[model samples]
Target: MTSQARRKKVAWGITGAGHYLTESFDLFVQFKDTFGVEVSITTFVSRAAEEVARVYGLFHYLQTISPGDYMEEVILESAQGWSYPKTGRFSRGNYDALFISPTTSNTVAKIAYGIADSLITNAVAHAIKGGIPVFLVPVDIEGRIESPVPYFINRDICVGCERCQEACPHDAINEQIDYLKCTGCGLCKDICDYNAIQGGQVMLVVRDIDKQNVKRLRKMERITVLDDPSQLERALRNVLTEEAG
Candidate 1:
């Protein structure tokens, strides 16, 4: 009821591993106060990351002001060497937009290749279908490249544990890097939890905010959750009711 949770709210969609969620939450804390601006984030996580998020304290903070709870949230379903989540809840038309942060190389690949077998990917495909704006921020992965500049791999850090490839939900992680399929979702790093993986150049950015920049928004003193179905429904019904009256 205080200013910490007041003002206009924007619907946010965060999907990936637990680490990205934590870093993103920390980033939001930096923008708690601003002029005529309030930002809020609500997210859904992979089943495995959910436990990590709980162990990492990310879960407690996220629940205090759930954008709409699991009823509106979802579990992602991955594939092959990785696990996936049930993703349709976030993809539904009610929410304003979607963002998959700390997007891993594999998640990026899924998006880049139009793989929609699971929830997040399916939703990503669907968001595009509706001409909705979708944002991605994959955690940096350390590896080789040949984008006319020969992106080299340290290999020294490569323990050959193969866990990253094992964690990919989209079957996109390959021994040899392929930029075309990598969408930068950051799942490998989040699942590692042991700091075993480093991301390649992933995708991330700020959108939906007004003239002001919102690289951070958790500490906002005035954030209003606008996606509440009741409120939206009421507002729409009022428009019709007023005309009838």
Candidate 2:
């Protein structure tokens, strides 16, 4: 095999994964074949995450690697340190970066605050030890840091079911909700019918994919806020593209 064609990978680790399962799934399909570098995505679903994935058709799009076949093969079958999904071997010798897209505000604060309750958070901490690059897409409407687009909005009437309270992954919702702390992805507001929920977008931060290099990635931002298989391809391609010139 030609050295250029030989595969070198940048492993991606996705968590809070339920929220963006469909997004993640589509991302793999769009780039996996074109890039030739394996686009492995791990869905770290607990019982709750699984339910969301099923309801939202996330599992359907992620069938191959979602631990069940109801979903499709666009998603790869991978696992975390504990049984989860991964793109390639992430051991000491396998990866170039660690990225978590759609990073929940809970996840962002936890990592920034030193909380490692789940697989993704734990991995982020681990990445630092090896000088690994870590990118993040923390979804929080908290304080209007800045936004690429307005958040999802609800135009219907209000039922006040408080059903949204049950769906919150971070217990951030309450009768008197704090918009600042909210990522505004609208998971809760979307499920409601009375239009009780409001608008705002989750923050998008690319934790590990270096921004200077992101230009080479074809359509990276749309898939998952944090991960982009094309980003890895660009990095790899640049190696020879630079050499060729």
lDDT of 2 by residue, 94-196 (tens): 4455555545545555565555556665665555654555655444423333333323234355555677777766565676444434444567767777665
lDDT value for candidate 2? 0.45
Identify the leading candidate in terms of TM-score. Answer: 2
Q: Estimate the TM-score of every prediction.
A: 0.42, 0.46
Q: What is candidate 1's lDDT per residue for 2-85, written digit by digit as tens?
A: 455443322334444533555555543332223113434345454444444543435555554343443333333322224332
What C-alpha lDDT do the candidate models reach, one value each?
A: 0.42, 0.45
Model 1 spans with C-alpha error above 4 angstroms: 1-21, 28-41, 65-92, 141-245
